[model samples]
Target: MSEAESELVQSITTPLRLEYQYTAGVASTRFLRGMADGKILGQRCPQCEKVYVPPRGSCARCGVATDLEVQVPGTGTITTFCVVRIPSDSLDIDPPFVAAHILLDGADIPFFALIQECHFDEVRMGMRVEAVWVDAEDLGPTFESIRYFRPIDEPDAPFESYKEHL
Candidate 1:
């Protein structure tokens, strides 16, 4: 290296640190408030007639502005899932759990959440599941208000029901 470049590289000794704070926008704020009240809110696209859980302010498909909010049932059908067998301290779940894509009743886009309250091997592509909320006392305006999804006491949804989601 050139002498000037070598000296400049050696002179760098401090590390950089910065703090970041985020403010949830209008659509997200409404969704979070609904979560705090044990509700799943979705926004309908007037043009496409599709509903989105955790709604964005605009439609991803038609690019139309989303303004109509709707409540969706917490129960949903599992579209697809993966069995997590690796041990990881960073994750809140134990090994051998499932991470699944679920389509809530009345919502079009599938939502991603954990599948618990049953053996990991029991999770099927079209299994019906329902949200398991944290106790009302511990609820907050955050996604953590919903702990996970558990298998409902119903038969698995027919393949055609969730085929489009997959």
Candidate 2:
């Protein structure tokens, strides 16, 4: 390397940090408020009639505004999932837990959530589950209001019921 380049490579390094805040828009505000009330709110697409949990304010498929509110049950089916065995500083969960894509009943798009109260090996596609929310006193306008999903006594959903979504 050139003498100038060699000297530059030996320069001391310093740490850089950035902090920021995020503002939730109208649609997301509504969804978060619903969570605070112990409700799962979704929006239905006027054109396609598909529902979305934690509404995006618009339908991705039809590219139309989704303003009609729909309240879906806490029950859903596990569309896909993974068994996490790696640890990370950001997550409080221990390893060997299941993380799954859950398609809430009445919603077209699936959302990510933690699976608990069952063995990781037993989690599978189409398994019926239900959200377990924090107590009313602990409820807040955050996704954390629903601690995690757990297996319910309902039968597994048929592949045909959610194949189109996949």
Candidate 3:
């Protein structure tokens, strides 16, 4: 074919869709159930005594089985964060919101959560925050059970408290 004809035929556009189902493992099942009951559950590593939220069933560092269940408080500290200025089609929130890594109390690993109900500029490392849960009747086995983390009235956590996690 001529180069002109090849260039004309090279471009195409189409809509694509996919669907799938997921089965949760024992650790995930237990964690999801705890979320449904308005609780933050973690598995304790017997070797190191470090608690992991969204338990992985085994210690990544110690390589030991983690069967002990520990309930961590919804309160946490913001170890790090960023201001999201870009808009997204999937989320209803406006631009310039804050997203942060929260070191939940009693858990060794930190997890990501959106920050709301406060000015984005006020967000800072070591800021104390707490989960804002959905209505009781709307609770389910999902992370959405907790809408987002918000700054609390308590003083910010000391740097020494969360420096290792960062």
Ten-residue segment with the worst summed lDDT in candidate 1? 4-13
Clash totals for all candidate models: 0, 0, 0
- As a TM-score, model 1 comes out at 0.87
Tens-digit lDDT string for candidate 3 (28-136): 8999999999999999999999999989899999999999999999999999999999999998999899989999999999999999999999999999999999999
Error of 2 at 165 (Å): 1.6
Better of 1 and 3 by lDDT: 3
Ranking of predictions according to TM-score: 3, 2, 1
Q: Score each candidate by Cα lDDT.
A: 0.91, 0.95, 0.95
| Residue 118's lDDT in candidate 2 | 97
CA lDDT for candidate 3: 0.95
Cα TM-score per model: 0.87, 0.90, 0.90
TM-score of 2: 0.90
lDDT of 1 by residue, 134-158 (tens): 9999888998899999999998999
Candidate 1 clash pair list: none
